[model samples]
Target: MTTFDNLLLDLDTASGILTITLNRPTKLNALNSATISDIHGAMQQALDDEQVRGIIMTGSGEKAFVAGADIAELAGLNEISGRRFAEQGQDAFALIEESTKPVIAAVNGFALGGGAELAMACHLRVASENARFGQPEVNLGLIPGYGGTQRLAQLVGKGKALEMMLTGDPIKADEALRLGLVNHVVPQAELLGFCQLLLMRILSKAPLAVGLVIDCVNAFYDPERHGYQTEANSFSRCCGSDDFREGTSAFLDKRPAAFTGN
Candidate 1:
């Protein structure tokens, strides 16, 4: 159980789900440099722990998943410092995007700018009915620096992504779902439970296969790799695993397959 100054990490050992709550409710759970560092550290810890099979990221209060980055912190940035800040945040969010275990964003309210970028980093997102998402950095005479310009377009398409960024407008949860920015829209109270249930369902499958599936999908967006080739390689690797043997044997035996992630 590692401690973080800006994060509350709760691990359910039985279900192997780690719920990470951003703890700065006063700031609308905004991303500051310290918070970004905390997230990177927390994610690294979760990825290294075998007991942690999945992750759910959300904010501490009903008001926000994250309103955006801390403007006060950004107010003093120059070109060099701004680039460094963007890179740091991008690296942290990249860890979430590349996690072997599933990471889902249970967005409660505002997810704007860097906040929206953070949600986009997760593999899946379930937003509360009251959630609002945007990349409103244009209003601040800037653009999304934390992978938002890229991931937002990838998730919602260039046309819609450009509209949001250019207009500095926020979309409600239902609209976000329609645009493929979020997976589901539910009541705020049910957000965490729904995400946990979703992760549990995924965790019931063969872990090795689940991780390989993530990698194979990610390969599609990697410039240096061929998606089909990656998928084929992943399939070949899975076939050589003990979990593959058990899955087939159990299917033939007419019983539930118990996987040990082998």
Candidate 2:
């Protein structure tokens, strides 16, 4: 319900999905500091809304999902300011990466630099046929500042990540898919719809289980954490939930399970 200068938030409570569009189409939906702040606020809003079980993020226009961070903003940063800027972006994106509700990037066009990092932060990415993705920060004499160096390597192999970052080259949607950077690549017109359908499919199941699944998977990448232990804990928690009982009973009764996310 909150208005933001950099983004548009549309929550479909009926579908339990929040669609957030980067609204600065004139600037190719770039991530300025204001826009990153808006995104963090919007993410918090979605997390607090029990009706929001999933989220879809995309750009407002056909030209881009996001071209990159605002160069003008980047151009003004000193060493101290630059470090703070990086941390701000990292914090904003950490929210997306850590969200219990699934977030899908519906990438319609250019997703470069910070934009690509934002997409990588999401649980999944569905790119349009015209979509382009890259980590071109090297061209600006910088490395990825928003967990892109980590997540990009995690999504694609380290070798591919290094190549892309080192070369400052962009890849088409199909290449992104081939590299496992994007889960699906569809026609531009169908990108949002496809992502929505995918979200609905995920939302139809037990919400608590979905959240725990996210937690368990994320633990795999944390050196200090053990994925197996996380999975065991999550499984035990799910077993104690009313939703799990309903799921089992519904199986016996041969009917669809209605979960309350308990």
- TM-score, cand. 1: 0.99
Measured with C-alpha atoms, the lDDT of residue 141 in candidate 2 is: 93
- Measured over all alpha carbons after superposition, the RMSD of each candidate to the real structure, in angstroms, is 0.7, 0.7
User: Could you give candidate 1's per-residue lDDT for residues 83-202 as a string of tens digits?
Assistant: 999999999999999998999999999999889999999999999999999989999999999999899889999999999999999999989999999999999889899999999999
TM per candidate comes to 0.99, 0.99
lDDT of 2 by residue, 58-162 (tens): 999998999999999999999999999999999999999989999999999999999999999999999999999999999999999999999999999999999
* lDDT, residue 168, candidate 2: 95
Ten-residue region with minimum lDDT total, candidate 1: 213-222
**lDDT computed for candidate 1:** 0.95
RMSD to native, candidate 2: 0.7
- Which stretches of model 1 miss by more than 4 angstroms? none
